[model samples]
Target: MEKFTTLTGVAAPLPIVNVDTDMIIPKQFLKTIKRTGLGASLFYEQRFNEDGSENEDFILNKPAYRNAKILVAGDNFGCGSSREHAPWALQDFGITCVISTSFADIFYNNCFKNGILPIVVSPEELEKLMDDASRGSNATLTVDLEAEEIRGPDGGRIPFKIDAFRRHCLLNGLDDIGLTMQKSEAIQGYEGRMSENRPWV
Candidate 1:
């Protein structure tokens, strides 16, 4: 996981709601446990046609949004099956944040774990960001985790709430494994004492 202190990047507008795990990673691409390559297949069914060609109509295929690091989507984003791969693909595709009116609980939690900021705000605020994102490459948004705000290109700032613990983890780049590693010395000492006291084992 990477440290996510602040990000200022292109914001792609995805107006669709209920973007499920299947549309995100797809079933066929689930065979591999790796996370990197999935970016190419993100939104597999919607991004590419049956002939494996880019679907020009999709927001991601547009030239301006091809390098989008953020997405402004409709309500109920990331609904459906509980697949961690959804966040993996989003992160792999360089999306550091997703702003929506609402998001599925599981997917929202998963975003924090994967270094992605899933922001939920009022529908009015979301629409404003969506409008800003419609301006193509100029749809620049600044997400400052420390400030807990999303700044738009039109000089508007919207505040968002995030768990303090999750904010700490993302700021320092600490995942579950990274959290455990913080106590490595204590763990090593415990193991040494156990070995010394129980030689037979």
Candidate 2:
């Protein structure tokens, strides 16, 4: 996982609510367990037609949002199945942060593990951000994790709250395995003592 201190880039507006994991990567693309290639298939169903051609109508296919680093979506984003691949696909698609009024619990936590920031904001605040993102190529937003603030293109600032421990982990690039590694010495010592005291086993 990568450290997520701050980010500044274009934000794609996705106002669809109840965006489930399947809608994100689709079931066909889940054949591979690897994370990198999924970006090309992110939102596969919506992004492509039955003939396997690009859909010009989808928000992501638009030239301005093709490289968007942040997403401003509608309420209850990432709902449905608890798939870790949802965040993986988002990260692979170059989305470092997602701002929505609310998110599914499992998907929200998975985002943090995969080095993606999932932000929960008020409905009124989301409207403001969505309006900013509607500017297409000019929809640049800045997210400062340390400061817990989001700055819009016109210099409007919004504050958000997150769990202190999750904030620390994201700042330092610590995942579950990374957290366990922090106590390696203690684990080693315990193993050594067990071996010495139980020689027969």
Candidate 3:
């Protein structure tokens, strides 16, 4: 996990709704448990043709969006299956922030764990962001997690809200494993006391 205090980069517009986990990385690419290689397969079906050639129509494959670091998507983003690999694939593709009107609960949670920021905004706000993302080479948006706001290319700002604890975790780069490590001293002390008090066992 990496700290996510602020992010500013090109935002790719993905206006399709109900984008599920399978649509993101596809089932064929799930053979590997590792997270590194999934980026190449992100949105595999939409990004490639039957013969495995690149699809020129997909937003991600377009010249201006190939290196997009943020995504402005439609409603119900990440809707199906609770696959952690979806966020992994998105993060691997250099997209650390996702702005949508709404997101599936499981996928939203998974984003935070993987150091990706999943933002929920109003339908009106999403429309604005999507318009900004349509600017091709100039589709830049700055996400300031600490300020809970998004700054668009034209200098317009949209505010958002998130759980305070999740914000803290992302700011400090603390995943579940990192959170547990914070209690290592207390855990060690308890184990030592238990060993001495119950040696016969």
Candidate 4:
């Protein structure tokens, strides 16, 4: 997990609603437990044609958004069965933050664990960002987590809310494993005590 203080990058506009986990990374790709290679399959269905050709009109397939680090999507983003791979694919594809009017609960929680920020904004605010993202080459938004602000290309800022604990996790880059490691010293001490008390076991 990497600390997410602030990010300024290309914002790809995906205005379609109900962008589910399977659409983000088709069900077939879920076989692999490893998280690294899923980037190529992020939005696999919409990105490729029947003959494995890149769909030219899709926002991610466009040249300007090929490296997009932020996504401005429609409502109900990441809706589907609880799959950790959803955020894995997004993070692997270099999307550090996702902005939408709403998100599925499980997917929203998974984002923080995988080092991706899932932001929930009002419908009106999301529409404004969606329009900003329509600019392609000019579509850049600054997400300041510390300040809870999203700055559009025109320098207008929109505020968002997040859970205090989740905010702390992302700010310090502390995933589940990272959080556990923070108590390593105490864990080691406990193990040492157990060894001394139960020599045979």
* Residue-level lDDT tens digits of model 1 in 107-198: 99999989999998998999899999999997699999999999989889999988999999999999899999999999999999989999
The deviation in Å at residue 46 for candidate 1 is 0.7
Q: Write the per-residue lDDT of candidate 2 for residues 1-201, one digit (tens) a residue.
A: 799999999999999999999998788777788888889989999999999999999999999999999999989999998888889999999998999999999999999898999999999999999999999987689999999999999999999998999999999999999999999999999989989999777
Worst 10 residues of 3 by lDDT: 24-33
Report the lDDT tens digits of candidate 3 across residue range 178-201: 999999999999999999999886
lDDT of 1 at 195: 95
Model 4 whole-model lDDT (C-alpha atoms): 0.93
Alpha-carbon shift of residue 64 in model 3 (angstroms): 0.6
Distance from true position, residue 63, model 3, in Å?
A: 1.2
The CA lDDT of each predicted structure is 0.92, 0.93, 0.93, 0.93
Model 3 lDDT at residue 172: 95
Q: How well is each residue in 65-148 modelled by candidate 4, as lDDT tens digits?
A: 999999999999999888899999999999999999889999999999999999999889988998898898776899999999
- Model 2 CA deviation exceeding 4 Å by range: none
In candidate 3, which residue ranges exceed 4 Å CA deviation? none
* Segments of candidate 4 deviating more than 4 angstroms: none
Q: Between the candidate structures 1 and 4, which one is better when assessed by lDDT? A: 4
For candidate 4, the clash count comes to 0
- TM-score against native, each model: 0.97, 0.96, 0.97, 0.97
